[model samples]
Target: MATPRIESHAFPRSWKDLIGHERIRSTLSSAIAKRRLGGSLLFVGPPGVGKTAAALLLAQTVLCRRQSAAEMNPCGQCPDCAQVRAATHPDLIQVSKPQDKSLIPLELLIGPVEARLQEGFCHDVHLRPMQGERKVAILHDADFLNEEGANCLLKTLEEPPANAVIILIGTSEQRQLPTIRSRCQTMRFTSPTGVEGRELLRQHIQRLTEAGQSPPSLADAELDEAIELAAGDLQVATRLASGQSNEIRGKLLTQLSASVPDPMIIARCINSHLDEISKKEAPLRRAGLRDLCSIAVQYYRGELREAARQGRYNGADARRLDRTLRVFREIDRSANLNALVDCYAADLSLAITGDRGSIG
Candidate 1:
């Protein structure tokens, strides 16, 4: 077959464009160099830690036209590398959530995504590349793949096609799949620091300026504010910049800044957030716990930061906030919340009268 034209929208082409996760990057590079790269790679990380980005970079490396037996990562300017970055390389497949929903429904596993999987898992890998060296299938949000979906993809996982690579990316506890998980080499990414995140915002700005386009999603202060709210999740910061965050950081900050001296209101705020998530959070699901704990931590950090900055909150209000934070942490750590929050509510009320001993 003739080499197809590279088709993806060109993105910032290398791992360099993605901030932090240096450890994960180094491991992947080493694997590629040793030609010991696994057919199945599990990128386990917090959201926005560049799991998806690194996967794409690896895809480009695997399919690079110039890669001989010698080099692993492709020279980005090469046709194969460019094509992968643009998301158009013929042999590369990008599988993500179903367009209509927030997740990949089970039907999709046996549908278009799997149809492609069927072709390449066995016979296709042995065939020469359509235009480049290998076929790539990137499974984003792999954790959302239900049991049936996971089983459906097992054939490929068990016996990946020759010269073929499958990349699985998922966040938090969803990152692991016991049977499938055992088969792959896992690369983990963590949230970067406020400092690192700000630096990335600067680079994004430079890129936007050079392109003569509207600058990237954040102004420096906006990025800092967002990173603080997100507890350093770049993906969250990006969403905030884009006005797409599920939670409005600015509005929340505003509310927190108001001089509400009432402990009831503080208790109520804590109840509302926990209540919204109570049913789904059993504290048993690792993914759910990870998300919940992270959120609570961020909330407390934001509250404290706001309180200190505004200086509008009295000690009673601050005490209630602190109590809520501690209780949330306890819940996150697997404490039974039905009783904990009730006691927390009482302490929050009594805390105003100078009593902190009984809640414990």
Candidate 2:
């Protein structure tokens, strides 16, 4: 039961406090200052990369009474800013997929069947601001919005209330419906990488230490591995730093590096580790499985690179890397966790053992 060194809920309150996305911050700040920001925007990026945080900051900047939107600054002391910080703002409406549900229900968008358009997000978004001049609606997990939900939202996006700002946060533009994508200004966000990533990790560790939440002394090598494996995701990097990543990585590499890897054993090992990480929560388990798949992708990629460097790269090595990558992609859309894990292990073992004919 390791305590999280960095809480995901601890989001940046201002542009300066956000870690990466310098270009995005600059563009947004300029737009806010010029009062030319769109009424509807889509924030697309990998998870844990500050899409939601930036949305909050934008809402605060627009709603802050002490400073005009032209200032592009939020006076944290203002009631608007304080309410946004505490998620109690009357004008700020937020929605996301429920933990038990796989999709953002249509009812959440347009009220229940008996109360359609009477008491839901769409209905609420149209109301006059109670404490501010404009309403700011943020819809998280936009990727989970089913077709019906997306259709119900089109009206709001097409003709929003005067001075209203609607922000949809998702991982990719392709995941959004075409009609939904066409009506909004899309801002793409990327994870911090290389030197920027390392610096951010250092800053995070320092913050944890200052707050007396730092884990046991971490070696530079451990930090470097975490950074490399995280591939620019700060949340994953922190999880890697929680002392579980090493054990998980060791198990993966040990099985993957064996002379004759066992698919069953690999599958069991991965599922067991996923269970430990997720505590049987299906969504958490899916996320944990994705993280482990990412680690495996890194492993295969390293092997491929090393082999190429030594002039030992071959068709078998290439296939192994390819299969690992495919498995990684499957984790996102697949629902059967146990079957996916089994197939992933079997496919990789087949690739590694040079049994290409038996694969697929």
Candidate 3:
């Protein structure tokens, strides 16, 4: 069966709707209450978390005409709130790296050669708010900002327009330039885990049902497996709950644990699964392959723990885990997916069967 896509409404619509990040919520709420929220903010966290959603919620709180900002409550029925939700608010400027490009183009920060400083994100941000007292700008994929692009944004970060809030969302603080990191109030977010993660998933499933959407029903075992595979990523868990990844995972574990796993068969199974999930799109296929590798890493680690518990762990077991780790990292730089898969399968087979040979 095909994986169900998460709907827009599934995303957080208010601070209360946002899952996890309790400390962040309290800090921002206190700042807003005291009218001391900074002009430039940096949100650093893993993907599938609520960084962007929190940014939007902040915008709504500051711009909502029906409610006072000090209350830290956005009246969702107001025009300002509606515009922000639809991403149609003139005062809210959002930018992200283009999928086809390796970096966020410098022109996006400033302007094209013919229109330098005349029009672009920097210019748009400096403009006075059209409907409210505040303007909010969010830059997604801030990790893709090249040196020139970062430089162009330096001045804006140093001195944002009055009542303007600029948010840069990325995976880690280390990925950002020193100047960018130093200029903004940084908020770190972590993925939900344990009871929090389980509650988050349950809430999502409940929301789908309440919204009258007929999502696939997950069995208790499947739900637990999805949670384990997702590792706190809600989006991945939703996909796994659809019953696709579970099948692939079962097959992968079975093959990896076999005494004489066939490299050709393993490669074919993985390739076929990738094709199904990615719809023949090369980028998505590569991403799926990396996710599968993450699963393998987990499996191998579990095996090592069990072996150690049984007093049978050895150097070969440690080497096998290391090989899997290397393969996971190399997937991003690999040019030929088929060749990489074939070689990885062969290497894994050799490691499992006590052979010293390896492709890498």
Question: Which numbered prediction scores highest in TM-score against the true structure?
Answer: 2
Find the number of clashing residue pairs for candidate 2.
0
Candidate 3 residue runs with Cα over 4 Å from true position: 1-8, 202-213, 219-221, 258-262, 283-287, 304-360
Worst 10 residues of 1 by lDDT: 1-10
**Residues 25-48, candidate 1, lDDT per residue (tens digit)?**
677777777877757878887665
Candidate 2, lDDT over the whole model:
0.76
Over all chains combined, what TM-score does candidate 3 have? 0.80
Candidates in order have lDDT scores of 0.59, 0.76, 0.75
lDDT by residue (238-258, candidate 3, tens digit) is 556655566788788888778
**TM-score to true structure, per model:** 0.61, 0.83, 0.80
* lDDT (10s digit) by residue, model 2, range 1-360: 011122334667567878778899888878876777757899998776778888888888888999987777788788888888777788988888776667887878888899999877889889998987888988888898878899999999988887689999998898899999998999999877656665566665554454556545766677677777866566666667656556777888888787557899899888988888776577678767766766876777788788889988656657766776566445554457888788778877777532336332
**Poorest stretch of ten by lDDT in candidate 2:** 1-10
- In model 2, what lDDT does residue 1 have? 9
lDDT of 1: 0.59
State each candidate's clash count. 3, 0, 0
Best-to-worst order by TM-score is 2, 3, 1
Can you give the lDDT of residue 114 in candidate 1?
Answer: 47
Off by over 4 Å in 1: 1-11, 69-73, 112-128, 203-225, 239-297, 301-360
